[model samples]
Structure formats: C-alpha cells, structure tokens
Target: MPIITRFYGIIIKMYFNDHLPPHFHAIYGEYNGVFDINTLEMTEGDLPNRAVKLIREWAELHQNELMKIWEKKVFKKLDGLK
Candidate 1:
C-alpha cells in the first residue's frame, strides 16, 4: 500500500492496480475502511464516526485529484486536513 496522505492519526492509501470502483483505503489504529472515490462512501470495513467524517471532508476536497491518481495507477501524496 502506498500512503497518499495522513492527518489526525488517519492514514490514507491506495494500491497500484487495485480492484474496481476506484477507491482508497483509510486506516486508523485497528480501524480500516475502503472508500469509493466517486461516492465517497465506505464500501468495506469500518472506522470510527469521527474518522469517517474527517475522511469524507478530506475526500471531498480532493476528489478530482484522487480520480486522476486512480486512473493513472500512480501514487501521489495529497494534502491532508489541517
């Protein structure tokens, strides 16, 4: 997994040549969730409400960039929430 961003103890990552629906992984401690880039919804796994909210906010801010990276199957560090 390649880390794309990190903030507030949350780690965001995406794997090269990953599965469909264009998604990224969010991890915090023992919690992990796979979120759809288009819908910004958790497709699998679970995370705390607060973490989920923060992730949604961050994702909203970088949705386009996320899609670009996903389509290119390239890793790029993104700016995280302050």
Candidate 2:
C-alpha cells in the first residue's frame, strides 16, 4: 500500500490489489479503518475522535481527485513496470 495521506499519527492509503467500491485505508499505528470514496462512508473500523474528524476533512478535501483516481482504475506504478 502507498501512503497517500498523513496526519495526526494516522496514515491513509490504498493497496494496488484493493477491490472496488472505491475505498482507502486509514491506519494509525496498530489501528486501521476503511473509508469509502463515493458516499464518504466510514466503511470499517475507526480512529480517535479528533483523528477521525481530521480524516473526514482530508477525505472531503480530496474527494474529487480520489474518485477520479479510483474510477480510472489506475495504479501509480506496478512492480513490473519498473
């Protein structure tokens, strides 16, 4: 997974092999959660209150770009491409 966003001890990311429904993972140390790009849904797990708020803001800020990336089904660079 690539570290797409970072703030408040949380690292938001996505895997090259992640499935559709357009989501990314928010990881805080040993904790993790899934956030949907479309509906802005916290699909799985969570973070502390302030962290969650920050993440929500981050997600919203990049909503359009995230969805654009997801919909295109593009991965930054796969292993063999190197």
Candidate 3:
C-alpha cells in the first residue's frame, strides 16, 4: 500500500490496481477502514469517531484531486489535512 496522506495520527493509503468502487484505506493505530471515494463512506473496518470525521472532511477537500489521481493511475502521496 502507498500512503497518500497522514494527519492527526491517521494514515491514508491506496493500492495501485486495487479493487473497485474507488476507495482508499485509512489507518489510525489499531483501527482501520476502507472508505469509498465518492460516497466517503466506510466500506469496511472501523476507526474512532473523531478520526472518521476528520477523514471524511479531509476526503471531501481532496475529492477532485483524488479522483484525478485515481483515473491517471498515479500512485503518489498527497498532502494531509491542512
């Protein structure tokens, strides 16, 4: 997995040629979740409420860039929540 962002001790990552629905993985300590890019919903797994909220907010902010990268098939770390 390649980390695309890190903030508030949370790490966001995605794998190249990954499974469908356009999603990414969010990891916070022992907690983790797979979030759908468009819906910003947790597809599976779990994380703290605060962390999840932060992640959703961050994802919303970068949705356009994320989708662009996804379509471009480029794997690169993105700036975390700011």
- Among the numbered candidates, top TM-score falls to 1
Root mean square deviation (Cα) for candidate 1:
0.6
Question: What local lDDT does model 2 show for residue 71?
Answer: 72
The true-versus-predicted C-alpha distance at residue 3 of model 2, in Å, is 1.2
Off by over 4 Å in 3: none
Candidate with the larger lDDT of 1 and 3: 1
Candidate 3 or 1, higher TM-score: 1
1 versus 2: better TM-score goes to: 1
Q: Name the candidate that leads on lDDT.
A: 1
Model 1: clashing residue pairs? none
Candidate 1 per-residue C-alpha lDDT over 1-82 given as tens digits, one digit per residue, 9 for 90 to 100: 8999999999999997888999999999999999999999999977999999999999999999999999988789999998
The Cα RMSD of model 2 versus the native structure comes to 6.5
Model 2 misplaced regions, further than 4 Å: 75-82
Worst 10 residues of 1 by lDDT: 15-24
Per-residue lDDT tens digits for candidate 3, residues 22-69, read: 888999999999999999999898798898999999999999888877
| Clashes per candidate (backbone, < 3 Å) | 0, 0, 0
By TM-score, how accurate is candidate 1? Answer: 0.97
Number of the candidate with higher TM-score, 2 or 3: 3
